[model samples]
Target: MSITSANQLELLQTAEAVAREKMIDPSLVIEAMEESLARAAKSRYGAEMDIRVDIDRKTGRATFTRVRTVVEDEELENYQAEFTVEQAKQYMSDPKVGDTFVEEVPPVEMGRIAAQSAKQVILQKVREAERDKQFEEYKDKVGTIINVLVKREEYGNVIVDLNPGEGVLRRNEKIGRESYRNGDRIRCYIKDVRREQRGPQIFLSRTAPEFMAELFKMEVPEIYDGIIEIKAVARDPGSRAKIAVISYDNSIDPVGACVGMRGSRVQAVVNELQGEKIDIIPWNEDQPTFLVNALQPAEVSKVVLDEEAGKIEVVVPEEQLSLAIGRRGQNVRLASQLTNLDIDIMTEEEESARRQAEFEQRTKLFMDTLDLDEFFAQLLVSEGFTNLEEVAYVEVSELLVIDGVDESTATELQMRARDYLEAQAAKALESARALGAEDSLIEFDGLSPQMVEALAKDGVKTLEDFATCADWELAGGWTTVDGERVKDDGVLEPFDLSLQEAQDMIMTARVLLGWVDPADLEPDAEELGDEEAASEEAEA
Candidate 1:
């Protein structure tokens, strides 16, 4: 049985057309058909069957040949299955048992099984070739934008038909508050391309951070040219974003360039982000100034930075607190993220209250423990001895050296100071346990419960324990957590340890041991002194 030349030519044209449509090479189809014929012949005629099929594309002519093995009787099965020595010798003079012989199998019957098998093989090869072509086309396009036709949403996520393939738009990556409908044309940034058993797949996203950056690059010529660098960017997606921009060129203003004339450039980017408000701030080398500017539309009275803690305390006027903090703290929150600092915003009143409370705490500690005579107390007050530790730590000699007190009085005062300090020390140690100072006391050699209890009553349990104790109290025999003798009041006078140091030491001791909460340590008074002073002077 034979097919007409016209039929063969028609099949060849159809194959060529399909190959072109699928972007696959046409010759692969002929090769596929030949391989199919060979496989079918082998299955039908047993292992002895070896055949080759060839088709001429232009002429549509076909030919077939069978391969055999030549061998001896001992290798007869091998020859029957493939080819053996003697049988192989009949085809080739120097052939060996393992040699195969090719013989032209006269154009055989056009059986239904062979034709169907050939068709199946062609279809499979076409599909595989198409998949490979699709993979190659998509693999190079990773991280680029592609237009996709929206298909039905699957499980609340949009599935798009990417011509020749399909892609998924995860719900999270879809633009917030935006909707897509079937047959809608949308553009998405390609995140990834993967080859699966079914076919090639692409993952797309509209909310990726890079999407914003890319949009900026496209919208801002300066950014694209690398003259203006996006130092940092933080986005709240559909609502608002804060971008820190810096110019590499001294002459160019990064913020101005990104904003464009009359805000055209940034507005375009904002529109792309679905009307998201963008704050284009000029980045500064000074953190305080940068943070102040970052919290725009609000005036900052002061910026106190605790670099080691990665924190910044911003003080604004009573009216500007809400503005500085923004709606629901969004402004400061984004500024903190952009600046890599934790921001604490306070109004002038809050800050004043904080400072006043601290001052009162120090004054109470000084007055309660020093027990200074009225005359001396007034003199101490005049000399700025607002805290007991300052008075305790001041040298008796220094006090005598002051204009009013004489040497004999200084000596008596020193002795009285010693007695007062001893009483305070005993009280501090006693109070230590109640103040959560037991573990720190354990570090010292002779810290008794009675001593801790006494100290606790006097509010001398922690490093703050001696905040009111005189130098003589520490010198008499008080020891640090390390068991080292506390420096004498006389020795510590010149050093004048600040209240902050005293508070820090207590916190540190607690941290080292775990007896007290770390939060007990308040912000250092001296830490805020400069800003407070400036604030007061400004008010004056």
Candidate 2:
């Protein structure tokens, strides 16, 4: 309560100056000053008394008062600040039980120590207000580019002065070989904004892929107009980057629009990036066609897509292999990142030679394993008999339908094939148990003996391992030659439904073990699309 009437206007002016410097409201500073004066008054007067201070905004007047409430004797929490109605009535003409009254108290003179305390209070409040303002300004700005002035450097990270506050560009987020001087202005993406114990912090990035996409949006009008969508971005910072853009209107060419006439639009982005080459790839819904566009300037002769595995095998001309792979495998790697698909580049000659080798290997396997003659083994191989399981598990009726196979012979073949598989299963099960697979897994309900054996062979010996297996690995979907049955094609194999049947078995085990809730990792799209898992649970 040290403020006096003569210089009260000086206090208001000081609060206004601090508020402007801190980018906080002047009312907040005035409130902090009022609280500061009340604390000092409490030290001089009875500490048990409830004291309050109010500062007039325009008049620069201060009021110091002791607050008391009239209440019943038994209702008093602090007797010094509350009294019975009979006691309060002696001071006021009329008083009710709930009435409140204030007694004017003389203001305390602000000593050196009290002035220091008031200064600390005002600074604390202003800093808090500043943090809240900064958080609100930048929280929604993440993933968008902003211009900032380089303020200083600490341990190779640049502290940039944002309009609201300072942001730091961490060392890893800076583009390779990029340097900044104090007072230099540069554009950066707001990667993250976090409220820490000390204050709010904004994280900036120059290497993020979203940065390039934002840059293109500024340079390309179609993208800003919502006619073109930036599908994805992949960058090799300080050197190369690729962006996939799709046009909502078929009439407009997204790539051409981004490239502009005489390459003006894309060139602006390149200059800003300090000569980093950019690839503007037209996005396509057909993945194969998209892959072709991604690997531009290199012709793709053939593309074999493995949808289940999320992989694409591209065959190019022999002379284009080096170009397709790029220098140090950068081209294909960036293309893979852009499409979110694993891409394998091969020459047409290499693909042809590989296919021939696989066919010969499969034919030899059939002959030796089945004890069939080369001609009969070739016939089986051409009929798409890629593995012994296909033969061992085929129906007798299906076997009879194949050429040169009669009933008696079919029965004999079935006996021999079953014997081989049984022996193999026994061997695999023994090896799995020896390796450390739990006995409980082997004895688990609803899991087929064949499936348990398969899992053990794959080294999924623990419940944890079994639960985390990806859907495709369990379902084991495979590709065929252009959706046609490849009788002799050795590159593809049908999924093992026996392994797929294990999906539900593993999920059920997870629930029983309490590793996960049945509600989590629901079987909807993730259960390998198999009926066995659902039916197994139903049967149980």
Candidate 3:
């Protein structure tokens, strides 16, 4: 191959076409072409010579040049890279060291290898520019939907063609059992954009709950207009879904707006989802009401909420039990996710039986612990006394609520409860002490009397021993109990601590033992102590 005046037009035309095809700026293509030409010119100029190339972006004409730095004789490293002052003086009258001299050279005759090298340079630059463009375009578009064409499927991964470039839809992001064919147009949310060695990766997803929410935003005008908001969504993909919606405008019913007129709006979404059934429910501020709404189409006779435990018990009629639980617990599971509460569903008959058994158990407990007759125990149980702890903690005024239990009887029962608790606590503390437990360990804030006893038995009998214990060990580490892994729940049932709480207790123990500076613990403890001492002295 050879370059001539006639073929310069062809070079310019080829550069433009390649730039357009590769989605790169034409200037970059021209620069790449020049660099490739310079490399080829190097073969003739001598490999050690510094060669450069410049191409006109407008006219597609190429120019060759050689660059050398002017240097003193002793500073010259290579004769080809640097021109001594004597040689430089011939080109310029006042040549100075560190000055660069660029001399124009005739264009090289294009060769087979030279053309191929130029082509590779242009292709490499174009690819880099394309990746940069893809990254910039899609980085800010993550969490938003984009239209794509299914280019092909490779090992269960779908190759999607976007307007910018080709993207990947990994198998994990695909909805369960959803299938795609080549040339099929689809809509997905841009989950992430990552720059890798090959190119920028734009990941698409159809399974994210956020993706489902975006679809609703597109389909529901109310949601887009901010008249309604999607609080949450739970999907059993390709089967069923539940969405919770709330309306900011009083006049607009959020659920009705999402469902559209005669189900047109929801049906549109359903059609796009391949006939996935959707239940749009109105959100409520009251969690119990919201939970009931989340589990729709099932008649809930009653809902018992235990907010502290994050659990809700729903009792339905015997005939509606299956419906409430759904086929394989789907309905209840979705409801739990939407409401952020664990749900337990039972039949009305089952709830009644449970209540009766609880009543008998509590009545018997009162009889044994309070030494009360059957009638009095029954009255105490009816008045909401479940265990000896409640009897020991309840106020005298509350005990008076029971019929035939006058102030005298209430006072006597309260005395007995206090005596029992004190006796039990003293026994635990004495046992802890007898087992070589330090007073500091026995009196730690978070450690119960029974926990101190247990620690003593385990040879952790001092403040240092308590501080060194792990959160899991302090809270009753996992132990095999009746073929099940259960935490020790401390030296006694219900004396469990969270990991953070246990860590805090350890820090407190360290501070008390002078292992940690009190100043560092609270920053003002020393000052506060001084102020208190001064005040006491003044009072004295």
Candidate 4:
């Protein structure tokens, strides 16, 4: 078909119709037509010639042009598309390199093969524009709940029609063994949107904790108005779930508001979630208090929190033990997820036994190390003296608080404790020296003799080795692997070194060893000091 013979207005109409159908911009379609026409013109003209086509948006008239560039002699690879400066002297008075020469060319007559190629090119461009539009539309919808109609099932994966695009609810993302058929209406959380080789992938999830949170936001007006905030959520898919919420307004109870009058609001959510049971717990700034609420239906006798380790211990009566642990430990597991802490639940009897065991251990340590009888050691342990260091460093007034102990007795007790610690320190220093520890490390201001021995055993015998160590490697930390927290034991962790202290000591070592400039750290030190001051002011 000859380009001139076809109706020019037809091209404009086709572009507009395709753009409207694909929900894309009309300019994209016109640009694609221009490119396809340029490709076809290149086939009619020599392929090496620089040919371009421009379509008028108003008139739909296709204009073809041949372009050539003036270039250096060596750079003139394409004779038809590029020309040397000397060769272009005939066309112009003077032509420099990088100058372009353009002239109008007759439009190409499209044969069967060229027509097919142009059609394919236009289709490809339209598809690309559509994919881009869909990606942008869905990407903004991530972390939101959307309604979709199930289109089909493939290998246990549900493909849903989202009107503007399609989404996939993978089998694992579905709640339990819930199955869907064609044309099933489902509400899903827009978990993620990714652009891949095939197209934009909209990942939908029904089991996400955020889905429940979103549902509550939709059902409860206070949550939507920002008066009630969903602090955290944990889900066991179709079986059970827990959500922690806080209310900013004193009159509104977040949990009660979510539960609604006669359980109407919560029931709506439960019906949508395949009858998944939900525990709506009130959120608290105190982690232990929040955890107590999370592990509901079980009375907790005591709560012990380890903030640094991100762990908590809950002591419950023997009768409540089974309820706290729940079936197969689901209750505790949900509680852990809700609070973002590792929980250890123990019965009251078990906790009592554990405490007794610890008391005996501390009593034995003092009895053996301080040359004291068991009765005297137990007295010290009962007075909150756990180790020899505490006894040795404590003031005499503290020791005098013990029953039947005078000033002289307090002095003698501290003397014995100090003597034992000094002997142990000397032994540790000798062991560290034997392990090739240098004075540079052993004499480091903050490190004790035992700390040096521990570092030496861990192959950090030099000051440089200590400087190269990461803070976490010296103070211990918890890491999440496969959704479970694993403990990373630090060499100095047994010494009770904090992460901030480890960082300061490492930086000090580096500065002293000329590995770091003291001036370079002044800005950071100032920032830290400013932060501390700000924190103190906030506390005040």
Steric collisions counted per model: 31, 0, 1, 0
Alpha-carbon error at 194 in model 3, in Å? Answer: 2.7
* Best by the lDDT measure: 4
Q: For model 2, give the 10-residue run with minimal summed lDDT.
A: 484-493
lDDT of 1 by residue, 456-514 (tens): 55455454444345534432223344422233332222334343444454446556556
The superposed Cα distance between candidate 1 and the true structure at residue 291, in angstroms, equals: 3.4
Clashes by residue pair, model 2: none
Who is ahead in TM-score, 1 or 2? 2
Off by over 4 Å in 1: 1-15, 27-35, 47-110, 285-289, 304-313, 348-540
Estimate the lDDT of model 3.
Answer: 0.83
Q: Candidate 4's residue-wise lDDT over 1-540, tens digit each? A: 988899998999999999999889999999999999999999999899999999999999999999999999998899999999999987867899989988999999999999999999999999999899999998998999998999999998999999877899999999986988899999999999999988899999999999999999999999999999999999999999999999999999999999999999999999999999999999999999899999998899999999988999999999999999999999999999999999999998999999999999999998888888999899999999988889889888998999989999988988988888899899999999999999999989999999999999999998999999999999999999998999999999999999999999999999999989999887687799999999999999
Please give the lDDT score at residue 125 for candidate 3.
79
Index of the highest-TM-score prediction: 4
Each prediction's RMSD over C-alphas, in Å, is 14.9, 8.1, 8.0, 1.8
Give candidate 1's total backbone clashes. 31
Candidate 2: misplaced stretches above 4 Å? 7-13, 46-50, 67-104, 392-419, 422-448, 454-503, 508-540
Q: Rank the candidates by lDDT, best first.
A: 4, 3, 2, 1
